[model samples]
Target: MLKTAFAPMALLAFVAALPAAARDVLVRDQAGFAAAAASLEPGDTIVLADGEWRDFAIKLVGEGTATSPITLTAQHPGKVILTGRSSLAVGGTHLVVSNLVFRNGFASGDEVIATRVGKRWSENLRLTGIMIDSFSNPDRRFEDHWVALYGRNIRVDHSHFEGKANAGAMLVVVREGKMPLDNRVTLDHNYFGHRPVLGSNGGETIRIGTSTESMSDSHSIVEDNVFERCDGEVEIVSVKSGGNVIRRNLFLASQGSVVLRHGNGNLVERNVFLGQGLPHTGGVRVINERQIVRDNYMEGLGGVDFTSAITVMNGVPNSPINRYLPVRGAVIERNTIIDAARITLGAGASDERSQAPQSTRFADNLIVNRDGKSPFRAEASLAGIAFVGNVASADPKVEGVVVERREVKLERAANGLLYPVGATAGAPRDLQPIAREATGVAWYPKPAGTRVAFGSGATVEVATGPALAAAVANARDGDVIQLRPAQYLLAEPLVVRRTLTLRGHSATLRFSAPTLFQLEDGASLQLRDLKLSGSAAPRQPGNAVIRASAKPMLVNYTVDIEDCAFAEMAGAPGFDVIATVPATLAETIRIVDTRIADVSGAVLAGHSEKGKEGFYNAERVVFDGLDMARVATIADLFRGGTDESTYGPQFTMTDSSIADSGAVLLSGVQETTITGNRFVRSGGIRVTHSVGSPHTEIAHNSFTATPAPVIEELHYTGPARALLADNRVSQ
Candidate 1:
């Protein structure tokens, strides 16, 4: 009886010694927050007051139990705004960060939210109800990430990350050391919105592992997310690690694919691609081994090749870890593909990537092609591939599988999707896609961007150099700065940031500046009826009349030079009439009714960006109705260097006249058509006709008294599939 009494007394003493119940501490500044956080116990809450918190480096490091987690939240959800070099560093176990907004700002360092600080890391942490909107660097070339996840058992849910107009993936799961990653992180119910075309390779939405961790297993899960118009690069969710599962996500009108890029043993299942016939919207691409793609529903995707509705890629023979690995045991089964552009097999075969997919099974899918387009286009051989139990609108007698095709009629499902009527479960009859409204926070508004029509804003007229410079600096978002018909000798270069038209009525703007006008990211410059010339003493600078950018940058709006004339550009050897620096990309460069004469350099030049994997600066280049003479090289527009991505470097130079110029180098581009153009004593067209760019045509062009070799074919591999016909050449 005495022993029982002593035990009860000891238990009572221990319970009395425990700290008081958890409390909520309100902090107004970073120092107060840090002080409150240091003394926090389990279940303690630190609430930040509602205000504009600028340049706050928050370090919420603590240790808490699973049942009573430490929380850092706002007084009101999304009322505590952080801007200008604000970052959140989270460490320790069971820590929760919720209900804050990081907007109109960029990270002071590389990451906005990093789970690991030095050697300390967070495990079993939850980051929920956060908004990172327009949190991008001023320089789009500089790379940064919103959330860089490390450690294990992390959950990022119900968040809104929008308007990432810079380099780097929005979120990345990284692992330290050389060991394989086993993070088990879950990314769910998030909205990745408004990621414009980054025009580079570092524009993925969520990248699980990287080329360094390609051979490792992450075991991560990305599900129930909505990717809204995230047209960054060719790969949206690049799965570079093994054993990760991506399921039930809605890729809504995005321009890239969910690529199994590097590692193997990944599963992509039940995702719905609601493309709605959007151009360049893609589904899934299969690479590596043991990847399973099953029970997915994709429709109205307009991308082809690597960005196809379903692309099974050809791999490199004996590839390294960073390069393309051969696709083995890729099981693609029971998917519904309707009204999509192309379901390609053996896609992206080149000089190095020549190994066909071995032991792959593509079975039990339903393909409905109503556009009368051939639903298939193959570059690699169909050996060792199996296509079985699939119902297609076209003929089912394709190479690979010997299984007979199924005869089924198409019927509209209740969810507005077309399904195989009277089909079983294996025919994808029960795949229920999620609604977009259920994912993100209802209060946080979705981003809306409208292409400001040219000359739609206030019309400001400027005559002098200072007036023109001031007008450009103070113009509205979509203003038209009409340069009065006079010679505006500008002393400094002008950088444009908004969508504007610089209309000059027979005006001449002569300058010695390296770049007369610089177009930054998200800026559009439309030069209408301007006579541009440069006659100052040459300073050996690679000057451009209207340079796009000198450094690497992200996507710019447009550069339309209509009815413009370039008299001369007297500068260094690398001078160009209108130039784009390396890795600086523009959406379109349409020079219509343009005339170039007495130019010492190329009309268009940006070919310095060259290396391994084919990434040029521009997406499309059009030189229509151009009259050119005395120019060095009439137009040397290098689009795709050696890219295997499906997005094209479309080039169309139709009805142009060139004389006494350099060679027109256009071999590395795709979607090319050079017809009805006249060349006189100048360099002929030099192009490579490979299997990768088979849809090329150089036809119906007259060459009078030209050189002996009018068309130089620099074939890389295989015979030329390009149509070089109906040319009249007189030597």
Candidate 2:
């Protein structure tokens, strides 16, 4: 095999019939090269001397079989440069062109192409170790597809392409004519860089598509390529093509990345992506079916939260209709995402037709968010999403964060079984009288009777997981509560409104009703080492097993909950769990070291009402090491209204894990910082209602399975004051 870094050894070996004679026919000038190339014979060699060859139009007029192909080589490798008034067209098959430079070629007004017309249809074409440059300047108006290819058995390797100053698309492959051939193209080890000086009208680095309709392709590969500062994008568009691969490519300062339309059985893996101006349409757009995207890096430039990191749609918008359509079915696995404050999966808008169903499977990934929650959405009917063995955490508060107590109870149980006695199981009955205090009052722990019992002297309740409700029902003010480890079933969310503490361990707390826990009416409470969950059955209603509903003017009321786990057990409802509350005025809350799993919508912090709805100003909230797995509504928080008037930013989550399902929802507040967390197998993140210079800092996090916009600053309303840095992001 006559192997060259640019030429495929397979193609070289196939042309075995070519004579091995080193006949170097030298052409010192353009005219000699033109005449010689026009009459070139098979097994012949055309060598150009080490000098400038200008105004030459070399077209293949002879045929070359796989066994006897012609060779065009530079006499001194890259010393020979060709400048032509028109493209150099090669219509013959099994050709080898290597180690030469093609620059300043005059392109037709219809197409700014420097190579042969892909429509000429040649198979087994090898373009290796060549440098093609277009220095046409920025003012030139070129056509869409540069370097258009339309044949099978194509090999483009070890090449360098630069569009010095032009507004054009690069490396386009499409079906040109009726006798279109299935392309088996190999694009590898290439360098694509656009002129950064041009600025405004730069071009995408690579594009693969069809001309009239979807073109069927058997095998195509794009690997080990480096693209930098190219206004162009790297994309795949197919109406009927199947089986392609894009792997191990480095992209920086590109417009966007995508896999759209009818291409099936495609694989995108091991690619590194960076930069911005992400089309404003999102990242990794997929409208095709049966595609596998894995082990890639997708990072953004500065702080621009456009959309999810990976967007898979069943169809495209109605307008600008193309030949290809969208469908369902995809596999997204093991890709690292960093610093994207928005959701990772995009299924179009809520009202679009051909919307993507939640059918994509996700597994074995690591996701992180810096200053905001992850934006990853999982719709209904999407099944078999395995999210196992992942960690989600964030940084600690340096400016001294406020801790609050929302729900507390005092009761007793035995041997992992509920006493089935009292109604408010572990809630201290004696404390009920003092539970309701005036608004804007802070309640600190007292060293009195029952309050100073177990677990940091927080409170000891005599209730197991099963008897938790009975214990709460019998709880009184200033009562100590001790609980055992096991399933303690409850009919309603335990509401704590007194200065009390509830402690439990080695026990499970089950809820038979909605809103597993609620803290309202000026209550200050603390909870530790407890497991709260919804009914352990399926098809439940819309309600969070643990909810905190407080009034707008309520102040100094805190809920400090730590080291607890919440889950929607087997066959539980499809959605809504963890936390839910209607918007109230201002309050303080904190949740630490908690785990939520297998439910729809993990947390809905505040729900708003109509007309002058209560204000919600949460003072200090900490979501430390909160891991959410397979739970719906992992990130689905909504602002009060659509219009700008009714909004505020008052929540901050530090150190949390949202690994799958739903999207991150941010509502009204002054400032919110989401630092050091993981968001995997989920949708995007949404933030609204910013007050003052309501800043959101997303620093040092991982998003391991989906594409999303990293939210740095919101437009008009306020600045996100987003700071994104030093992170690992993969596509």
Candidate 3:
């Protein structure tokens, strides 16, 4: 540490004003670095020796001139590794840090890297060419920020941050103190990759500021970043401060929107959302005031609610900073939106958020939607909104958007994007195409592994041993392994790594091992007409018969179970009949016309920890046309213990019969429906914590005697909506 003998301000000026002769100091280890750190002067460059430097708490603190800044870099770029609980703290003026990689670990504390240490602040710092890849904590509940920026004039560019499986944002330009000051920060040319569904609020890739400082100005610029498969939450880039410019970012196949959640005077333009018709892929969502969204292009997105392309949300009256504030003076224009699911105006209009958006202008935009949904959807009143010069190609019959409905043909360009054939239909003036090769470090490639192209295969039948394993091993993407009509006893777990089906027609698969079927990343399972059971002593490891990938995956898992029977199954203390590993999720788990009986644990375990925001193992679960009985619980889908999460499990169970079991019903889901079912001698249904909307329905069901309909006994909050009627209760 540099000792200050003179007055603090005068000493800072005296040190910052002096420019030392430039020198290069080579240090092999932390001990060697510490010996030279205390005497660091302006224009000094400290070069760390490459190769595994594990668990090093590096602190660089000193003043440097703007013209001659101090730098800390690696002897060899892309070779210096900071693994196993390492952190960096830089507290001073005019410093440049570059070319260090963080891998296979997390921070020792709440932050992996902080620009300030305690009350000491940093100014005019630049960090570039850094990579934090798959750097995660084991405990998903433990939230840690990767980068926390403080003070003024900081820039983090040409970096790659990927696979943050745990909670917390990847980068946050922090604004502290009771009266926070303006901090000018820039985050550009970064690559954010493959963030899984965190199922809660702490999953933003970049958050400029928080709610307490939402009214303050950060003056941050986040542009030219590439976010690929970043399905962390509804808000990928959560802008929570004022006077920020978010432009020219490319979101490729991601499932979240850039939301202006708070603050005012933000400009969002020229961003391209190329989703390829993936579900839950969104464009931009607008809230609060003085936000302009223009010159953006979106195509092949399928999301609703807050993930809608341009969601002008409903607001709470006189809301606080953290809550949903009223939308005022929002301008959305000059954009080309094609093949998106919906563009919502006044979305999420509930009794809680009764105030609609005010003084909004939607003008001169071209929308082409071909996914059978209307291009524009207005859930709230459009009294204060002005719609002008907008053109729609599909379903232009929607109200409040009185634009021309015409044929706007599209052609697939060389860049794989759909462009208008030739038109002046109020689209953007120019297509600002961002190059795919212009973001992130040149050394670090995309975090997503090689995309495997599986060949078409014929259906193979097998009984057991390497024959069955070989059949599965030789299977391709759409292949089916037809099981023989006999007991296929599995000794070891069969891990499925491809998209295939297990055709078990009147066949029984007995799980002697911990897991009968394990799914790695990008795996999908279709099990039909099968009987799944366990041995005399059931195996452990989540007490699950099947498990998903242990780590966060780029493409989420999808499992479809139909006409399947489960009985005589027992597992570890906390087991699910169908379960996934922590921090990993199955996008859709649809169980239809199935029967489950004699399970010791819940029929399904939602492996989310308590007291965490937006943590879930599955995105959407459907239990339709099934018969479940004699289980601990039919479906225990509970993202329990918090009102902070906005992501929902989105549960739906209709036309089913659940007997002699308990049911949790719903918890922390965005939308739920428990309709058209027969409950016999069960604990009944309970609904808790309706996150964003209160659209829960428990309607049109029949309950046997001894368990009266108890919708409000477990939770009396306003989550349970109307239509809890039309139920037949037998006395």
The TM-score-based order of candidates, best leading, equals: 1, 3, 2
TM-score for predicted model 2 compared with the true structure: 0.47
What's the lDDT for all of these models? 0.81, 0.52, 0.79
Query: For candidate 3, what is the TM-score?
Result: 0.83
Worst 10 residues of 1 by lDDT: 707-716
- TM-score of model 1 vs. true structure: 0.87
Expressed as tens digits, the lDDT of each residue in 622-652 for candidate 1 is 9999998877876575644344443656678
User: CA shift at 647, candidate 2, in angstroms?
Assistant: 27
Residue-wise C-alpha lDDT for candidate 2, range 1-731, written one tens digit per residue: 34566487667686886555544588787677777776666677788788777766556544566777777778866676766544456666777777777666644343333335444666777877676666342232233444666667778777777653444456766554564546778888777654222111223455555434443554678777766555322232222356778776666555445455455677877766555533322345555567787766554522222224665543444423352254446776665544443433344323333344345565444344444344454432233233433222222121221112112221223321111132221111121111111111122111122122223423445654445555554555444466766557665567665555666774676666655666664455567787766554335555665455643212224567788776654354544543534433223466778877777555544444322322333434566778777765554333332221111334566667777566766654445666777767666465654322345665676766744534532334322355555444555
lDDT of 3 by residue, 361-399 (tens): 988788887654566788889887888887778655656
Please list the residue runs of candidate 2 whose C-alpha ends up more than 4 Å from where it truly belongs after superposition.
Answer: 1-22, 65-68, 84-86, 104-119, 137-140, 195-202, 233-240, 275-283, 299-308, 314-324, 350-354, 375-731
Clashes found in each candidate (C-alpha, N, C closer than 3 A): 1, 135, 2
RMSD of 1: 4.0
Q: How far is candidate 2 from the true structure (C-alpha RMSD, Å)?
A: 28.1
